[model samples]
Target chain A: MLASLGRGRLLACAALTVLVSGCATPAFDQARALHHAGDSAAGLSVLISAQDTIPERDQLLLLLEQGTLELFDGQSSAAARQFVSAADYIDAEDRISLRDEARALVTSEATTRYTGEYAEQLLAHSHAMLGFLLSGQAESAAVEARRAGKRLREHEDTLDSATFTRALMALSFEMAGQTNDAYVSARALPAGTWPATAARLAQQLGSSDADTLAPSALNNALASARGELVLAVATGQVSTKYSSHLNNGLAWQIAFPAYRPVDAPTPALSLQLANGKTPAHERASTNINQLLRQSLDARAGALLARQSLRLSAKHNLAKELRAKDELGAQLLAIALFVSEVADTRGWYSLPARFDLYRVAVPVGADSLTATVRGKSYTVDLNALDYSRGPVLRLMKF
Target chain B: MFRSLSRSLALAAAFASLALAGCAATTRAIDPGSDIQYDAQYSFSDKNAIVKDLTDSLLNRAAYSADQAPIMVVYDVVNETSEHISTSGITDDIRIALLQSGRYRFISREQRANLKAELQEQGAAAQRVASARKLGAQFILAGSLRSIEKEQPKQWRLNRKKLVYYSLNLEMTDIQTGEIRWADKAEIARESSQPIIGW
Candidate 1:
């Protein structure tokens, strides 16, 4: 009887191990690999094919990744659709689910629905804005810009101001012929964030600036240009979270997810006209890596406190079972340890930094050359239907 | 002792499995007019209410002769709100209600393209007949939807509250005279609270 009981306990332990391991498998490894290999189309295909395999809990992350790949694949309309779906899901899931939270505390955070980090949520709106602008839906783009601003305001206490989204909002308002609204957005931009562009836009929108009173040639060109060409280039990959183990001389070790250190310099992209006249270079408008770090930092205290509570609960349970049955206690301890794996899943396909370049294009100007990371690529402005408003072109590396 | 331990282990395992499995999803039909609100965001109740109120206001308030229904074209309702609301839905509902009341007439904006295509296909023959058959709208119906949302500031609280107010202002303009003849607005305001901590 003793031997059979021991065998039964071992079998139960094995079964628990299998269940935990199945849930711990990362969902986006294959998709991320294909995306980083410069095959976003293939990456998008993999995600679509694996839709059934992806748990409902990870649907938000999947949508975000698919949207990014779609945008990179030059399917802006399709990308916009995906982002809209994501936004809908986010809106519907705005309230926390008690059931999911309960399950997360007992099992793993991965078991809960991925509501999305604050940065990811804001970027969803920003990307949707870009997708609509590129597809010549200026009205839809303006709506997304307002949505992004609303989200920023909702989380103003926790998140830093997103300069990229603010700039896009100003530009979208301008395209939609809401000049007063556009001026409001432009003036709201933080000082020294987009110095030249903001000043020029504010000045053009009738914001009298003593500093910009002198009429420079660039100002004249911008004032008389037929349309503006906006280039957004994404460079380098954002850092990923990994499982971190902590052994504090306790019976059970604590495991949590931590972001890997990313120390790369901000990347820049410069645009030059067909006549070899280089426009003023602007600093990177957004640093997603920093945003991710700040988001994680903001939640660190909560995460650690939850982990501590979980440790105590598991330890107490194991200690009680040890007094009743030695073999069962051992089996339970093993099961708990295996199930303690961190939830490191996240939107891994995002770029580390975003560089935006805006320049006024004269009539009949078809294309311009963009130089980034010692490589030059010709961007076609004529392909876009600029009659609606300013045209946008995106590049990823 | 071993039996009790086995029972205890089984109970714990069952609890863990239940937590992991979660509750299965279920769906049931409810009355469309039911005022059920899940959050501060817009809901179907709001849509239903707006359509009913606006349709009633337009039908009762507009100055028109009972001899004949005024010819009108329902233009686009610009969505200036943050949400991706299909303002067309509101316009479509209002149009349906007005037509059913037999108090108004509407020219289909979507069918205009088909009408143009048919005229082009028929060349000169259709144009000769179209000039006499073409109906000109006397009033143009247009509007815009806007919203103002306010969120509770982050603080040490057990619940977070959000308030959203939506205003849909619609108007009828005299096409020839370029004068606003009628206007009305429907508004919805809702507040929702969500618990910060969940079991």
Candidate 2:
């Protein structure tokens, strides 16, 4: 009887270890470590290999990381493919899982499938469109931009319009000689810090001719006169998982993913226009951390319920075990404690913020230098294959 | 021993109850014209109602439905929606409802091949069909589906709702005069909220 009890305790410990540790793919950590160690090539290899092991639910996350890494490596074609696949996967109804809900209520979010946060979904679509744009496939980029716009309107409720996406679309329309359509797209730009250029483009199109124009309209008209240069900036780490305790009148404290943030270094960019003029860029877009905060707040109540239920179950199970074997009861308590660790599994490769900057360039200016993190990235307008005129440039730093 | 066994039985019963409660599934057939499925980006009932409403507007207009039924061709229904929606399906529904109302004679774009073949096979030299000008559509029905989605401010998981607004705009134009004879729009709004963990 004693031997049997010991075996049960050992099995419980094993189960708890598996439950808590397997929440995140082991390969993700390995790939991240490689990237941090300045071996992105090897990190790419790790992610590629991890595909076979990733569950269908988390496949979107894998694709997102791979796409971003490929973009960083200047393999725009490969990155575009990954982003397209990720976008397609997200569009399909395959991610919805009714079964995971029950498990989530009984255990924690780690037990449920992680169908990425809304921000991540929008960002993935944007990145895919960016890939197509960078690969000089403006037509494909235009289609993706439309799809992303539709998805953003359908899924995200935040006041933020997808400025980067609209900018890409405007550039695409401008290149295709669909200036009217480009003007319409630019006009849709929300009057904000990031969309000032788009508003200005609309004004240049003569859509806003009022003397006392909206600030956005004025900016749009001015930008239309001189060629506009757009810089998309990615900085810092997105949120990371830490434990947040909720006192739900339970015997055990529940540790959920509500803790410390993993911050990435944010760098300011300096632009040197091809016309020998260096202009200071203004912030025109969002950092997307607000989205992360909203997603977490949305999940808080449900997470608390799950945490409370899990603790209550543990308490009951421990009591039951104590009546049978003291050693088994103690082992179960330890197992519960171990399993209570927060599920920090997420797309840790995501940048802390995605911001946009635009500056006016002269007609003769065909290149520019974007300095970020003390390194220079050249935007060669002349070298870029634009069907009409270069309207926007995407650079990763 | 009796008390311990009872305790075990009670625990099992509680678990069984929880399991059964979680497994409860109920379903019923609904009137297709009014049924709304959860997570539907666009509902069939909304489409059906839009078609009926638009058809009514056209029928109410004496200019569109003259003493003799006006000959109208359904030109196109543009899917200006973000998603890949088959606008033709909605147009077909509109066509059927319009025909049943006896408001107009419908010229089929799909049947043009058959019409051409019949016209050619029966021409037989004396028919004088080879040089005849193509019959133009008298009035044309054209429409577009436009959608805008709004999300409520983020709240707790149980309270977050995504609201999608869809507007179906239709117009009948006098092709010869290039003037719109009838125009109408139908609007649908649907709100969806997700459970804590599901997609």
Candidate 3:
């Protein structure tokens, strides 16, 4: 009996070692422990060490975890590389467990069916982030965005929600001080594309997700897109709306009058006190024009100083498109509000100038016969125009 | 002994949770409240002729396809915002607006496609890419906005101050010889939450 027991003990020892090393090893536990213990680097190291023992494919989960942590600390480019690499390794159809969990949290009913790509969804998150960043850099960023947009439109059917989001983000970024992200989303937003992200959200808020958006949501989206159309059409700024100087050196030397509210449709919310073109003050060596021209450089410096293009843990807006639960409602509200203005406002006008105009009309029986900058033309209903020299009949209504 | 081990594991898990909690406590969280504090403005699809007029002018700005000479373009822009947004947003927006304008035609993929044939012929294509006499883009225009923070009491809320102010600048540039072709500037300001003084 003692001999048999001894043999059993030896087998048990071997089995235990195999079991620990096979699936959940000591190092794996250590990594999880570190991840929980506020030492992500240590966790990463432990995870990386375990890679030699397991399949490289298994490391995808570990890479994703590490990449997420890296992104939160503002390492977007690095995080992107990690994510792209993981994508290259895995099939697009493989369900991401983490993403699945997030999706589950949003749904109220039992989820019996789910299909699609999580990586693509993550790409949307990335695109939205980049779009948000680009919105802040409306000038230089427009070129690449325009190129990307044209590419996305040609393959729209094949593009997923995330890719669509990227294209839209590009559209949104260009729509500074205006209406929805779609107004100027493309250096070449397509001729007939109508984005429904905001409308979808509004619809989800008011109706069941199983059905299409409520008419109200569609109306809201349509209205927002119209706001974009106003900027595209009225401003005559195909490539540029505001002067560099206007953007910088904004030290308005308005004889500082308390702003008189223009009683218009979208009544001017501006105080009108400091809307002066002249600077309140400037260095003697720098004229206001020169000061303003050089302001983007200063603004760039300030931007660099103030914010880093890192990921956020709590506000994972990039991942929100996949997270079905009206996740970006607040953000969507903010973004939609911004998109409307960016699409309608002239770049040469102040951002607040966008507040003055209430609505625009075709000035004719057809939708295409509107006047801008003094010229008239017929166009499709969905056309977005941001060029110059067309006449716009100023409607004070 | 097993019970004792379970108790120890519970303590370890609690201790682990504490470390994560501590790290998060030190980091500053982005303010989620300020996300929706802005106003909404709108436009209409019911209006079409207006959209056409707006786009046509934009196309006129980008019409660099005269067949007789190359177009020249230079990148110029302004930073008029407190937030680090890209001017490309507006510029690209302008480009799209122009594409739909119908009156103007920019150099298309076909024109660039001829570059290889040009290179096969000699450095002539390279030179054309550099000259306004041979390329597609005539000029590049760009700009930005500047805003300042103003702390004023909220009109609707008690004792709460609102922050506001925004401004803009724009410029056009000649691609060849890098000259400032034309420039313009404008400003707009907004105030949210005026003082409900008596409160």
Rank by DockQ (best first): 1, 2, 3
Write the residue-wise lDDT of candidate 2 on A22-113 in tens digits.
47787877886665454667888999987899876577778888887787667877898888788777655333366865555435567655
Reproduced native contacts, each prediction: 0.46, 0.20, 0.03
What 10-residue stretch in candidate 3 chain A is worst by lDDT?
Answer: A279-288
Of candidates 3 and 1, the better by TM-score: 1
lDDT of 1 by residue, A1-397 (tens): 3244464664475456438533633447787788877899998888888878887888898889999999999999889888988988887787658887656565556677887778888889888988887786767888898888888877775556567777878777776656666667766777655555556656656776626644444446666776767777887888998878887553677777788987766567667777777743333277887887677777788789877877777677667777767877777767776677677777889888876666777666677887767877797767765554556788877
User: What TM-score, computed on C-alpha atoms, does each candidate reach?
Assistant: 0.81, 0.62, 0.25
Weakest 10 consecutive residues, lDDT, candidate 3 chain B? B39-48
lDDT measured at residue B152 in model 2 versus the true structure, 0 to 100: 63
Q: Quantify how close model 3 is to the true structure by its C-alpha RMSD in Å.
A: 28.7
Ranking by TM-score: 1, 2, 3
Give the TM-score between model 2's chain B and the true chain B. Answer: 0.72
Which whole-number lDDT from 0 to 100 does residue A23 have in model 1?
62
**CAPRI tier of model 1:** acceptable
Worst 10 residues of 1 chain A by lDDT: A18-27
**lDDT of all the models against the reference?**
0.75, 0.64, 0.35
Better of 1 and 2 by TM-score: 1
| Per-residue C-alpha lDDT of model 2 across residues B1-199, encoded as one tens digit per residue | 9999999999999999999999999899877767667684876777787888777777777434435777666644655554446677888887787778776776666564454455434533223122121344566677778776666654555545677888899887676666777888988888886554454
Error of 2 at A33 (Å): 4.7
Among all candidates shown, the one with the greatest DockQ? 1
